[model samples]
Target chain A: MAGAIRLAAGVVEGSRAALSRAITLVESSLPDDFARATELFVELTRQQARRPTAHALRVGITGPPGAGKSTFIEALGRQLLDGGKRLAVLAVDPSSATSGGSILGDKTRMHALACHPSAFVRPSPSSGALGGVALRTHDAALLCEAAGFDHVLFETVGVGQSEVEVANMVDMTVVLLPPGSGDGLQAIKRGLIEHADLIVVTKADGELRAPAAALAREYATAMSMLRRRWRGWRTPVLTCSSHSPADVRAVLGCVRDFHATALRSGRFEQNRSEQELRLLFSAVQGELAFRLRTDARINALIREQHRRIVGGEVAPRVAADCLSTLFVERMRGGQSAQ
Target chain B: MAGAIRLAAGVVEGSRAALSRAITLVESSLPDDFARATELFVELTRQQARRPTAHALRVGITGPPGAGKSTFIEALGRQLLDGGKRLAVLAVDPSSATSGGSILGDKTRMHALACHPSAFVRPSPSSGALGGVALRTHDAALLCEAAGFDHVLFETVGVGQSEVEVANMVDMTVVLLPPGSGDGLQAIKRGLIEHADLIVVTKADGELRAPAAALAREYATAMSMLRRRWRGWRTPVLTCSSHSPADVRAVLGCVRDFHATALRSGRFEQNRSEQELRLLFSAVQGELAFRLRTDARINALIREQHRRIVGGEVAPRVAADCLSTLFVERMRGGQSAQ
Candidate 1:
């Protein structure tokens, strides 16, 4: 306990490496390591300063492959850097080879921004968690804020629901699309259209510029039809080209303006609190489900019922009922201690 | 028990209303009604025909909201009707205002097919399930097949993960899009490109026709990059304009051909069985999680632990371990019989 407290104190004193290591220690999903992780987690939480840093704007960007999302982020990061704002980029990629591990290699795709002194870029791969958002992303975002980054952008692999979770966690969800009006097609896949704060058309350089602008206009129209009213903010559909510095700056300017308003209206704190509460529930639900699945007796009963249900020995409803009753009895008997 | 046996006997004789009612009874999330449902389920399973009628093709269609999904399905259903093929449409639209319950009103959107004599349209709104596929969609599909429908098309509320679930359950997943091209921008959205058996560019009717065709070719190239091959089948990208009957028929032909191949290669049975197994697990998981959450002692402990962790008094890992241990002990104590 003393060693854990001392380690947490080091993390609190702006030690980036220590913070990173601490996060890794805490985020482990392994069953055996959980005890140590919990002890450290308690220390880290208690010792961490409660003082709020100057609020940084959190922007979540998501889309599918070839969506130019990394390019857009790099372009936007440069713009932020040019404005003398410190920026942190957390890029989450798809799991490679289905090994239940992430490649965490978006840094290679983001070259220029990574070279900038004012920017810190980290790429994380999807870890078998239900949306692609790394479970650590939330804590990492806070660490980045404490590290004095004025802006934190979370880049997600283009699977839509993961982005929605990202959207819920961040202040703004900026969905990037390549040139042309094809974005309208993507709307069908994303499912949660109402959550998008902004839609930017990327790769708008050269001849694609005209079409990109047209696509932006088309998206604006589509978004309006979906919302049907003046929301507190109408999602802006704007054209941005990574190859064009001026256009990229405009996207950053829009984000700055959004943050200014959010902070002034005190909406930012409210949003964060709501997100934290949601995160707690999501985590607990996940833990409960995982524990139930790994239970030996319950696992056997579930499998037996599944077989019977499949074999026509029982209906799914009956099977479910039988299982539910057994579970309730288990709980009543205090048999869940491991 | 006798009543359930009688009811099961009625469903076995191919009573449409009885089958529908049986599914409704099974799908009920309530606990008390479950015993009766199970009793009936066992009997129905006993009489489940080894093979019902001739082979029926099950295709899943999913995309974002304004992707003209309803319009496209209407066109596809009309094409099947013209060819004198019996078609059944299952629409999962579970988005609701108060509870997010899907209105399941795709029949209204698909006027032509809804009125067709040879077509049966059932839209089931999602009821809090993560994926847009209805919890009982597999059962419903089976019932539809028993009712003599030669084809079952499952339409999901597209948001990539849900769409993937739908695709996994069905023989084919048709991903619909609007025309135009470019990469990286659209890649951020969740569901679009992955698990797409065929990429169908919708709205190819008007001035967008040429560009739509061009986009189709682009998607064909993109699909090649997404997955080299899936289940020993090469993915195809097709173009369709809901306004064009010929284009619509082309899509139907693809679905038919896919179904024929799946059946011949025994992939169809394998897919259906896999879907059933998945359904079994999903039911068990969902029920267990729900019960654990609502359990009084568990819920109280969770609340207390949450407060302690949030207050920085207890480590999240420690609290989780303690709770998990307690839960396991409770389960083993045979209170599960309660």
Candidate 2:
């Protein structure tokens, strides 16, 4: 408890080192770390409840692997700092195989920004359960806000479904596609159209500039046809070039506009509140899995039902009901201490 | 119990009327209907366990609004009947408003096949919870198989993400794209590549023939580049024209080949077992939500946790643990009768 309190004190004092350590602690998903993280978060939440910290503008940047998301982020990070905004970049790639490369490579790609005192870049948390990783990322973002970052940009690859969860956690989701109109086909595969607040036609450099413009126009037409998920704004498609760096500001401008409009329309708070609700339910799922996994009686029940399910002796849905009834019955038999 | 037995007996006797009624029973998702459905399924499972009934080859067909899925199914149904195969076409559209049009439109599009003695075309079950809808569709498929259908093909619109669930419930998933290569963008929006076991270029007739061929080639190349989730056979992109019923045989042949290779490699059984496991877990989630709604104390606990979550007094993950712990304690306090 004392250690957690000290960590919370360091975190609230705007120590990036403390914030980074807090994130690492929360990322482990171990029971002890989870307990400490909870204590720290509770203290953090209580402190903020009184002090009322300013929430940072959370912008989610997602694209395919080669869409130059990191380069664009580097350019955007520099722009934000130049505009006198403290920025934090958290990349949420939840794959262990690529985590090492992703973390190291991100630092290399954003070398100038990484060295900047105003900019903080943390790689993906160590991957475990997808839900757990998402929870940690959400906490890490809040920690960055508590540490007084003016803006937090979450960058991730959209091939996995993690981006959808990340979108719910952020104020705005920006999906970037490569230049050519043909390449925009990928924007569909990635399921970005529905979730993005802004879509960037990235790598609009050299000879790709004309094609990128055409692609943007094509996407704008496509966007018009689809019903918007949120009110007060329609997702816009724009072009950006890492080489120019100025285009970064254009995308950032759209981000600012979206933030302002969503806040004005009340969707910002509504969306954040809903994200918390979803997080609660998702955590419920995680907790259920944890209990079923760790409790011997629950594990036995699940195994028995699973066997019947696999043996074709009972329907999975029916077996699920049996398991549920048995679980309640077990709990009723006074085995709640564990 | 007697009513359930009667329904089970009739279903096992290959009576389409009984099968349809059993389906309706499962589709309601009402407590009485769910209880009856469970009883009927338990009887059926016990019987099948003793007699080892042959499972039908389940296939899923999904496409965008105008991909000609129903027409192709009509064409394919005739061919299957001509080959003396008993086929069941279960269309699982979960939206009620669209259900009215789909049920009516499909009867019109498939009038000939619907009236044929060996063919059965059931429209989507009445809409409800997506999980419930998915559960009922799966059970309906099993009933159709138990009713002696040699082939049971599930048909649904791909836009709803329902196809992903249907994919898990079936042996093969076919994603249909319209003729034009340009229209293939709809295929992109539908996210057909990753989950599709076969990509069909539908409506390859008249002016659409050349375009359909090109589209098929384009998709074949795209399919090759993307990682194949299923082993033993790579996904094949083929062209099919409703005008040319001969193409139906080619697709059926491909489906059979994929099935044969999968069974040979033991992935078929492995896949089916995994589906059962997934179904069991999904049912657990549904059951949890059901309990949370019905159990007052549990609901109260969840409500309190929700308030804490919304108030930002605790992180959602932490709140979830508190809810789980509270739920068990509530149940342990001799409240099981509810």
Candidate 3:
């Protein structure tokens, strides 16, 4: 209990080491750590409520696996730190279904940023349900803000669903694209492109410059055709080269502009509320999924109904009726008339 | 109670007019009617268990607007009826977000097929949640099969999330495509294309025949690269024209061949159980969503948390924690300790 208080205080006082420890506590699967982490998170939120924050720029970078996300973040992080802004970087490695091993070999890739003061970089695995990991990201971002960071960058590898998740969690989303034809275009989901505030053509160095510019132009045209869901903001496509620090700074410049527009239009607060509501709803859904899987009677009832369904004797609606009935009854710890 | 029993009896006894009435009952939005309809469904399911069935073939057809879905289904229905198989059709109107109104102007489009002795056609508007429509579709299909139909087809418009819902509820999924540049390709989501069992190029008339075949070829090449999730079955692409009755029969033939392969490979029962399991999970999740929306205290708590979050006084994870807490406490009929 005392440890949790110190940890909370340390995080609120901008102790980077304490921030890392707090994240570890929250991500820990142990029940004790989980309980303590919840307490810390609540306290931190209350503290956030009592004090005004610097309104940190929360930006997300997402793309296909080989889109050079880490290198680009490192370059961007250095630029922000040089501008005298405190920054925190969090990397979410996609959960591999086959190996269950995280691809967060990201520390070495961002070695300089990791060593720099006024900058903190952490790479974490998706240790639980996707929603759970998302919730953890939310908690970690708050922790960074409480730790006095003026900017928080969320980096993830993937195209479709993860892009949507990170976009919901951040102020602005930047989709990194590689120079190519339909091969890369197809990999970048249309849904991802729809939500992007900025689409960056990565690896725009040396031989890839011309194709990257062409790809950016193609993206610009496609984006122009899409009616903007948000008022007063249109998604733009840009080319950036990690080799050129100027290009990295330009990406940062565009993000600042987007943030300014969001603030001016009040979408900044609107996005935060929407993101919070989404997390709240999903958390309830996740809890219910937990109940469905963990409840002995409910699980047994579903299996029995599924068995009858497989026998071609029970319809899905009937099965749904029986299961919902059993689930509610089981939750109430009451016996059914049958 | 007597009315529900009579309706159940009428449906099971294969009275076409009674079958339509029973569908109307289950699809009713009134609470009392919903209760009666559920009773009717449970009884019908029990009766179905006691009797022997032909194990109806359930197929799902999905595509973009104007993929010739209704016309092709009408033609296919005639072929199936000619083969002495009873058929039932259900059309799920896309939610009003995109098209604003249903294009399932199916009544006139399928006038002949609807008049056939061995076929039943029903078009349902998305009156509630998509899951509600899906569950109603499940119940309606059972009503038809209980009425002795040997084949059931579930059809929906668009290639977004709703298609995935229908795909989960049916045994075989048929994705329809029109011959075009990247329009159709962009419409088919990556996840949807991965699970497709058969991809059909529609509108293959005399002038469009060549492009249709080429589209089929392109789809075949892409499908070949996808690893089939179901054992011993590969997704195949074919061309069909509504003007040519033989092409209609050929789609039926291919579907039968795929169904036979699934049965021979033991995937038929496997698919049934998997599909049933998915429905069971979604049913629980849907109920949870319903509860979240309806419960006063939970709703109030969520709104309060959302307001705090919007004020930037709370983080998302903190908001989720508070909402979940109030929900549980309210479910217990007690005030939160805080």
Candidate 4:
């Protein structure tokens, strides 16, 4: 408990090492670490309430593989630092849950930003359930905020549900697309466009410039037909090239405009509160599923039911009812004994 | 219990009305209906064991909206009927869960097939949790098999998880694509191609002929790049105009050939057994989630935790842990008291 309080204090004091340790603690699935992580969060939340720091803008950036997300982030992070703003980049990579290696927020991919005194870049947590990884990323973002980062960017691959998960945690969501419109088709299929607050066609320079512009126009037309996600704001489709400083600056300008509009409308805070509530339920579901998978008696029951189902002696639904009833009964017995 | 036995016997005797009632019984959520449904399934399984009926072919058809799925099914059904086969068509529409109106398996949509004496068409079950709807669909297919339907077709929209659910319940999965390659992009984005056992480009006639051909070629090339899903079978990409009898026959031939290969290799029965096991686990998960939502004490605890979470007074993970522990304790108490 004392260690957790000290770590929370260090985070509030803007200690990057402490913030890193706090994220590691939250990411750990060990029982001891989990309790400590909870204590750290309690302390940090108390500190936040007492001091009431400036509201940090949380942005989610997602795109298909090879969409130049890291390059764009490096450029944007440098621009933010130059403007005297502290930035933190945290990634949510579902792929890491299987491979135990993340393809996002690698220090090497954003060397300049990672080395910058005003910047912190954390890779996705290594191997765990995808839900656990996402929850840990959410905690890591909160730690970054506690460390006084002015802007936090959550980078996720748009291939799966992770992008949607990241979008829910952030105030604004930006989707990046490649030069060719055909390549952007997956983003549309994944319904990323619907969640996007801003869209960017990266590599909009040299030979790729025309195609990037064409893709942007196509998306713009598509967006015009769909209902607006945010009140009084149309999702902007823009082109950006990492090589062009002006292009990078223009993208940052659009983001700032969005943050300002959302804050002014009071939707930013309201969205955050709603997201917290949703997260609470999601966490509960995850816990229930975890216990169902891990508990010894439940495991035995599941295996027996599974055999009967496969043998055609029992219907799946009947077996499911049996298991759930027995599980609840066992839980009740434990409580009464206590 | 006597009524359930009579219904099960009627189903085995190939009575369509009894089959329909059995489906409704399985779909019902009422406690009395649930018990009746379990009895019906148990009796049906016992009858099935005694008879050891012929293995019926279960095929799943899925496509994005505007893919001419109904027309294709109608054409395919007519051909199968002419070949002296009985067919049952069942749909899994997630949209119907919200609208209470199914967009698939409408009698009007497949008028000729619906009017045929040898065919049965059932719409999506009205307004239930998606898992419940899916489970009911699975049971309906089983009942159709019991009623001596040689071919059972499960149709679903390609937009969401329903297609995947339908695919898991069937022996083969057929994904339909519209003429234009652009429209087919969404199918690829959803990873429908990976689950598909066969891919078809619909409306291959008149002005759309060339585009349909082009789309088929595009998909064929794309599938060539992907690793084969089923051993000894490369998913076929075909262009079909429902108005052409030869095209319809060609598709049916392909489906038959795939079924033959799967049966010869002993994969067909193995796959069915695997699917049954998976269904058992899915049912358990669904039941657990349902209780979490409907249980009064659990709901109250969730509301309290949600409040604390939104107020930042408790971390989501911590709240989840507390709720799960208390829920288990409560369950134990109830069992002990009983």
Candidate 5:
């Protein structure tokens, strides 16, 4: 109890070392540690999270691997810190084998940014998640706010359908693109493009600057055709070089403008509500699937049904009906009559 | 009733014109016509679809819109025709206002194949689906099979997340890719790729042939990683040039091998059963959501809850819980206690 109280006080007092240790504790997987972590999680959710005026903006940055996301984010972190804002950067990398889970070693990739006064960099591995956003990214973002970080940035590995999942959690989504590669535009998923609050053409430094600018213009024109689902705000495409603070500031200004507009129009709350429902539905579906898979009787019955189906006794629809019925009954704690 | 009887008889007798008309009727939205179509569908499902042994091998071909899907499928159809196989192609195109719904106009794109004796091409526009597959693709596949097509190929507009929904219903999935694009291996989505029984690198002609072959090799290597989840057969990636009949034959051979393996291992029934469950879940979710949107009392309660949520009196999760509780209670006609 004393240790827990000390940890709580350390977090509330804004000790980076203490916060880092707390996050490590949260990410730990050992049975006893996980139980302790769950206690911390519950306490954190109860005590530190109830801020009325001190809301933190959640930003999501995603691009393909090898797209220089770390470098750009490191530069962006410095820019934000210079403006006197505290930032929390969470990069979700692929899972680590040593700990048998995510280590979040993204700080190793952005070494200079790690030592910054007003920034925290945490790398959470993909952990074989198809949707990319580590399940803990949401909780970590809230914790960063509770720890008084003004801004929280989530960096995704930018593979598969994970970008959309990140979009659901953030206030704004920035899609990073590498320059000199014509393949950049083609790789931008329609789903991702639609959800992006801003598109940034990165690596706009050197001889590739002209091509990057051209790509930015192309995205700008393409975005014009997609009708904005959000009433007042239009998704913009911009060019930036990690080497240039001016370009980085311009991107940050866009983020600020989007947030201001969203807050003023009540779209922010609408977006949050939609996200909450989505999370709830996703949780329900995931839990339902997990329960169905783990129920020994149902699993065995499913196998038997599959065998009967192969032997040509039950129709596919009928077998599905039985499963759904069983799943519902089990959810209700027995195979009751429907 | 006589008209329905004639339609049923014509379908059973494998009359080409009758099958085309039946599909047209099924795709119609007119209320009275839909009533008749539903009756026809029920009769067809009962009498014809029960014999899974006689069902056509339903193949789903999907990729990006401009990936030359129609041309490639047409070429493949011609090859199958020459080999004495009757081919029925369902092209699911995005609905354009000027093109009218359910176009079926492939004459301009594949003029030669349209005239082939053993080929029947029907292009149905996606009416309301944001995902690539037309709303009618699944039922159309069933109708085509009932009409005696040995092979019913569903050519979706592209490989978006929604396209996987269509692929789930088909017996085999063939993901088409162009050569020289770095996205070859990146196209392997966890949800979609596992369903992709065969991967065909299309447009592998002229300068692109070498790169296409390389891409195929990369896809095969990537597929090997996923092979652990795959039960018995390997998901082979083959290179094919639509202009080359031999390349087309290679793709055809892969399909035959996949089908034979599925049948021998009894995976076909297992897959179909899983698909049925997914379909039912999707249907229920859709129906419930639509009802929630349309029902006045529920809609009113949801709006009221949203207003409360925006005012910060209630957390979004609690609001959702309340709404879902109300919805489920109303859906069940107040039988269960809230």
Candidate 6:
């Protein structure tokens, strides 16, 4: 507990190493580590309460593969750093769960930005379920804020539900699209377009400029038909070429403008509050699932029921009901036995 | 229990009304209804084991909105009915949870098929989480089989993870694309293409014919670059016009071929067994979540923690840990008190 408190204090004192260690502690699943991590969070929360300044602005950037998300983030991060903002880049790579290695937020991928003194880049958590990865990423973001990072950017692959997870944790969501990817209608149909606070068409330099503009126009038209996510704010579709400083600056400007508007409209605080509540519930769900999976009796019951289900002797739903009933009975039995 | 047994007997005897009622029972969340539903499934399982005949061929058809899914299903269903097959069409509409009504599986949308004596068409479940909806759909499909349906077709919107859910419940998955929608690259990027056992380019009539063929070729090329979902079975990309009987028949032929191949390779039974296990685990998770939500003490604790979390006195993760620990203690305490 003392070590955890010291670590928390170091994090609040803006030590990058301490922040990284704090994230590792929170991500640990061992019982002792989990307890210490909880203590660390409590201490961090105390320090946060004592000095409540404006929280760091969190932005989520997501795009389909080949959308140049890494290059774009590097460009954007450099610009943000030039403006004297301490930045942290975190990746939520759901694919890491399967591959056992993260494909996003590899420091080598964003060499200069990662090496910058004012920036922190952390790869996705390489193990556990997608939900676990998301929870760890959320903790890492909090650690970054405690370490005095004024801006946090979460980059996630846009192919699946991870983007939605990232969007829930961030103040703004920016979806990057490659030039000439096709009509925004498909993205809209996939429900990706609606989650975007800002849409950027990447690689809008040289011969790709025309197609990029066309894609942006398509998204703008599609977005106009949807209800605004934030009151009094319109989702902007812009073009960016990461190689160009001006394009990078324009995208950053849009992000800042969106953040300012969200803050002014009180939507920023409201979103944070709602997101925290969601986090609590999700954590509870995760814990329940963990308990269910780890209970020895439940596992034995599941194995026996699974055999019967596969053998065609019982319906899956029937087996499910049997297992759930057993679980509920066990819980009640636990209370009564005491 | 007696009523449930009688309903199960009716289902096995191919009574349509009894089958519908059984589905309703399984979909019900009321304690009494849930108990009866379990009894019904138990009886159904016994009868099923006694017969030990070849199970129904379950196929999943998913496509984005505006992809002519209903028209295609109706046309293909009519052809199957003409071939002396009993067909049941179920829609897994995740949207129904929010809209309080199902947009898919409306009898009017497939007027002739829904009115056919040998056909069964059911809309999506209108309440519950997506997991619950999926569980009910799984139960409904099993009920249809118990009632002697030779073919079960699940139609789901191809947006989000619902298609993945439907795919797990069926033997074959068919994805539909509209003509001139775009290159197959975006769909491939979204990871939708790999889930398909077959791809159909719909609206291949009149002026759309050329574009449909082009779209089919594009998907064919894209699919060629990836691995076969089933060994020795290359996913076919076909062009279909619901208005054309030949096109509809071609699509049906591909579905049957895929089903036949799957059965021959023993992949059909393997997939079903694996899906059953997944169903069992998901059901357990859902039950746990339900208990956590409905427990009055836990709810009160959550409310208190939520306030602190929103007030910035505690971090969300910290609150989550606190709630989860309390829940665990409550479970143990319940046992100890008894």
Q: Fraction of native Cα contacts kept in each candidate? A: 0.43, 0.52, 0.47, 0.57, 0.06, 0.68
Residue-by-residue lDDT tens digits, candidate 4, A81-166: 99999999887776776557776645457889989999999876666632376567778878888899989998888876667777
Candidate 3 lDDT, tens digit per residue, A1-338? 67777888899888988999988876776756766777787677666566756768888888877788888888888888999999999886545322366765645568889898898888764465334766777877878888999899988876456677778788888888878546555856576787789999999989999999998998899999999859998998899998898899888899888989999999998887777787877876676666466556546666787787777666666677666654444333344443
TM-score of 6: 0.65
List model 1 lDDT by residue over B1-338, tens digit each. Answer: 88777766666565556755765664555555455665665655556545335547888887665567888988888877888887888875434423465634545667778777778776574363321233466656665665567788888766534666677667778888767434532752335567777778888877888888898888788787775444666678888888888888888788877777777877777776566556665665566566656778656766777676555455444565566566565655543332
Model 5's CAPRI class? incorrect
Candidate 1 chain B: minimum summed lDDT over ten consecutive residues — where? B125-134
Highest TM-score: give the candidate number. Answer: 4
What digit string (tens of lDDT, one per residue) describes model 5 on residues B102-142?
Answer: 43344347776678777777765435431113325655766
Residue B30's lDDT within candidate 1 is: 59
Ranking by lDDT: 4, 6, 2, 3, 5, 1
| Candidate 4 clashes between residue pairs 3 or more apart in a chain or in different chains | A331-B331, A331-B332, A332-B331, A332-B332, A332-B333, A333-B332, A333-B333, A334-B332
- TM-score, cand. 3: 0.65
DockQ, candidate no. 1: 0.24
- Candidates' TM-scores? 0.58, 0.64, 0.65, 0.66, 0.61, 0.65
**What are the per-model numbers of colliding residue pairs?**
62, 0, 0, 8, 4, 9
lDDT of each: 0.66, 0.77, 0.76, 0.80, 0.66, 0.80
Q: Please write out the lDDT profile of model 2 over residues B222-331, one tens digit for every residue.
A: 88888876666788999999768689889888988888998899988888888877777667767766666566655566677878777767767678767766554443
In model 3, which regions exceed 4 Å deviation? Answer: A28-33, A46-53, A93-107, A129-131, A183-189, A221-225, A292-338, B1-7, B17-129, B132-141, B148-281, B294-297, B311-314, B329-338
Per-candidate DockQ values are: 0.24, 0.26, 0.24, 0.30, 0.10, 0.33
Instruction: Please give the distance, in angstroms, between residue B90's alpha carbon in candidate 5 and its true position after superposition.
Output: 4.4
Can you tell me which runs of candidate 4 are displaced by over 4 Å?
A1-10, A25-55, A65-67, A95-107, A160-162, A177-190, A201-225, A237-250, A300-314, A322-338, B1-9, B24-129, B132-138, B141-278, B291-297, B331-338
Give the per-residue lDDT digits (tens) of candidate 2, residues A55-88.
Answer: 8999988877677888888888888999999999
